[model samples]
Target: MMRITDHPVLGPLENKEVTIQFNGVDYIGLENESIAATLLANGIRTLRYSEKERKPRGIYCGIGHCYECRVTVNGERSVRACITPVKDQMIVESQGFQS
Candidate 1:
């Protein structure tokens, strides 16, 4: 993702890079960064789809207020990616009926 190398006040981010599995594909992300950020960095903006219209949905509101960024983590469903931290070997799946 577009991580800030040095936050003017917080200094450099030392979070180690970790590999995460999204939709069966491997992607690199910071250990502590949000899953949503990691996916967005990898050009994966469509997190899910609208139930009725079958429209693609991504990050909205960004603070967990909206459930547009929902996804399946490991074996858990309805997990919010915007708030979940990425970890090594974490398996994330896009929530929808498409695949």
Candidate 2:
């Protein structure tokens, strides 16, 4: 539903469907697309909870400068989703700030 059908400069993006598990929900996204882009495209706004207040946090900087989009990939902690590429059958867990 969130996939871009047409672009002004890039034109229609090719659809190569790939599945990624987020918070135990299976969602479809483009292959090789950044995890942050994929999550945003799928209407996933909150990627993690704040360390102290436990407030919801999502992609603040798309270039990995901000650590808001941190998620656990394949049991690896603190993986930045903004720069990480999506892989088939990847397990993504919404993580909170590590104390």
Candidate 3:
């Protein structure tokens, strides 16, 4: 997966690195950052899928306003990844067929 190792404007971000499990795969992300940000940093764009049309959905409005960025977190359903911070060992999964 593609990752943002360095940013031109922000340069290299210095934050506490933590491991989070996504779909049973381990990925390292920054602690206290939003789950969506972590996922985007790790090249994860599709967060969930629509129940009706089964369309892929991702971050939109990114501030807890839109529900498109919903994902399952630690067995909890409909969790907003855009606003939820990444925690160490947190299990996150895309809401694939769950409605």
Candidate 4:
């Protein structure tokens, strides 16, 4: 959803296919795109859950203004997927409240 295919000024963005893992499953994503954007392009929207309510949260305020898109990246918690670039073979896991 966030990929810039064609812009009036930037024209186009060039990206190559990349491999990334999400929740133990490997998926194909574009290089240099944000983790949240890649996940959204793959139709996976739930990035994390509310700390208390356990409600599914995703790319809300995608510009990094909110924590709704936070997820675990490479065993690190509280990583904001919406702004974090997706690295090839990067590991991403949905974050849920510790219960």
Model 4 worst lDDT window (10 residues): 4-13
In TM-score terms, candidate 1 sits at: 0.85
Worst 10 residues of 2 by lDDT: 4-13
**Model 1, range 1-99, lDDT digits (tens) per residue?**
376444333344457989999988999987767788889889899998878888898999766779899999998998988877788999999877674
Backbone clash numbers for all candidates listed: 0, 0, 0, 0
Clashing pairs for model 1 are none
Regions of candidate 4 where Cα sits further than 4 Å from its true position: 6-13, 97-99
* Per-residue lDDT over 1-99 for candidate 2, one digit per residue giving the tens place of the 0 to 100 score: 655454333345457889999989998888777777788898998889988899898989777788888999999989998878788899999987433
CA-lDDT, candidates in order: 0.82, 0.81, 0.82, 0.80
Lowest summed-lDDT stretch of 10 residues in model 1?
4-13
Q: Per lDDT, what order, best first?
A: 3, 1, 2, 4
Report the C-alpha lDDT of model 4 over 1-99, residue by residue, as the tens digit.
Answer: 456454333344457889899998988777767788789888897888787899889998877777889899999999988778778889999988643
Stretches of candidate 1 above 4 Å error?
4-14
For model 4, what is the C-alpha lDDT against the true structure? Answer: 0.80
Off by over 4 Å in 3: 1-14
